[model samples]
Target: MTCTKIAYVVAGTISIFLGVLAFHVYEVYNQDDPDVFPHNLFFPLWFSMDWPSQRTYPFPDHIQYVDRQYYAEILRNPDYAQKLRDENAQYQILDRLFRLKIIRDKFGIPLTLTLDESDTFSMWVEPKYPTFHGIDVGIGKKDGRLYVLYNWHIHSVNLFEDINGMIADIGSQFDSMVCSDKPTVVDGDLVTIDLLLPSSLNDPNKVAEKCGDREYRMCVQGTYHLHNTSGSPVGVLGYTGVIDFTHLGINRGFRVKSLQLKTTENGKRVLYKLN
Candidate 1:
């Protein structure tokens, strides 16, 4: 190629490179210094945390659920020069907003639901004895009190029937607390249940024939808020008390069980009766 043509080509390439760099510099200069929250982003990004360890919350996978953590991590990632290329680093860009409806319904209405401000949507419960915690997880209530069951229990099941059976077995065989008859809540009706413990269940000295005489006593109590809908609804009740949990999984320690619940007419409402 001729010297003149070569020089012209080099000049054009250098100009194009300079223009790209100038645009980048201009963007950095004009960028707003974010304070606390961004003035550009007035929309609140909210999410419920799920802590299997109750700390070092694993950020939600959704962009909105983890926008702050994502962007902040992106900014904090510095070019590392250790042995070779950095391993624990990620590069990210903030260039989009996600918008969609949050669905927390099971089946459909007469069991359809609209989230109320007062209504419990989710929870991050830490047990009374934080140190003795089993696990913590995010729970969205589909029908009503189901959220309580899901949050409190860590058995790794989500089906309503599965949850119900787990509660029944846990109450009866483990905790000595029994669940009242099948829930009688109706659609849109808010029902509060004052569940009671079995008389001898919480006794510290209570012994079982199967235990070979290792007796431990602990109290079990729980109050569940049950709501029923025309659609089949299954919910949960959470409680805590003291007991020897040495046999926590073998039905040895304090736990929950289901009791046959009888309902009798009271004024115009039916109330639970446990025999």
Candidate 2:
């Protein structure tokens, strides 16, 4: 090749090498600055490169529920973290409630449910003392009727029939408390019953402190606003009493021990304390 031709080829090659090096330097310096995209002219602004500043949240494969703890840790801000925890607690409570079975009507009008505001759905779990596991209690509306659902963990076969049988046995006691002839539904882990509203809310004689051989005592009291299906305003019940959950055996999966619900106004309601 001629020397002139060789020189020209080398010049072109050097220009290309210099151009590539300058582009690499530009990318390294400006990639982190999201604002630099608008000024660039050589390359299309849309041409993308991964930046360290960007973050991603990928969903897990096996985890069915939200990873609340992971988010809390990453959030760092105390207010947001606390909010997340509260939401998680609310979610878990709702999950348990949704799984509960309607106790009274085996087959009847499917009652739609609505809970009090998220802030109102609170719980106080008493630590298990020896054989008597503590109870879980909360109040909500089933269609137009106000009801409370409460339960404790038990050792039992995870079969539907066995759970139902346990509900029938334990529920008999629950029924006596509220004077309810309604049947019970079994949720997972514990026998969660959709309590049947008692026919006789005024019958104080029906409260059962003993079921078969087991002896127990229970009391429930709270005040909450009631709402109808249309989400209209319903009057709030203002009355308070101690929730007395005495010693109860672990056998038969204590569904509802005993519930004593009262209101200032003359409202027809039976709040049974489940043992």
Candidate 3:
């Protein structure tokens, strides 16, 4: 082959090699999974990228020495030593990180809430056929007062087959008075009446006397109320609740409507209805 032809062949080979290398690099960087790259290649890259040199804590050696001394003290305590041994392996790794201050000081982001500026409402219900039983609402001071509003529902069903109207007759009283009274104000916070629907609807003696030996599922729905004793308008900051599903089995839950506190022009606090 002529020298010029040979040079052209070599250039073609080099171009193909470069294209394959570029494709591999792109796959390593753009893939959804971080483990796309082999550990040997990934660890160096990750360490260099997140080395924390710019924000390195001073006296790391001293910190390590202190941590070792404290760990030695823990080892001297038989109970603590046994506890450490009983910990899971992953927890042990986290404990080491905490000792080194890597997972402690470096990741110590405190969450704070200013109660005076924030308001919240929450409900806790029994884990039964219907998830709601009671609720609690809190309205934070705006101008000087707080306000809250809520609603809920309750339901009961007789599971036993009705034969000769016997079971139906017994279960009929399950719908008797469940929840009553408006929300009451206590210490400037509006609180709901704690209602346990299951206890009332599923009473064994009552069910036997009224509906015979039968199964009944009960649920509750209603609105909780709040009072603003602070004399100022209130604003809600966050709302949360603990839901119980132990009795109802899986995939059953409760829903609540949005509640808010608003100030009227005359500085009166009232429940804000959503449009």
Top lDDT hit: 2
Residues 1-275 of candidate 2 have per-residue lDDT tens digits of 99999899879866875585456445544454333322211211121111212112232211111223423443554353233224432332223223334322221222223335532321221111112222333333333343444433221122343434344456456556863344333232222222333454323333332222221121222334433345543334322211222322231112222222221223333232222
Error of 2 at 31 (Å): 47
- Expressed as tens digits, the lDDT of each residue in 1-275 for candidate 3 is 99999899879866865575455555455556534323111101011111111112122122221133433544565463223222322232222223332223423322121233233222221211111222222222233333333222122222322331443344444544543344444445444332222224323344223311212211222222222333232233122111122311221222111222232324433333210
TM-score top scorer: 2
What does candidate 1's lDDT look like per residue over 65-115, in tens digits? 223333354345333111001111000000000010111232222222122
Q: Per-candidate RMSD vs. true structure?
A: 26.9, 26.7, 31.2
lDDT of 1: 0.29
TM-score of candidate 3 against the unseen true structure: 0.17
Q: Which stretches of candidate 2 lie over 4 Å from their true place?
A: 1-75, 80-86, 103-229, 232-266, 272-275
Q: How high is each candidate's TM-score? A: 0.19, 0.21, 0.17
Error of model 3, residue 77, in angstroms: 28
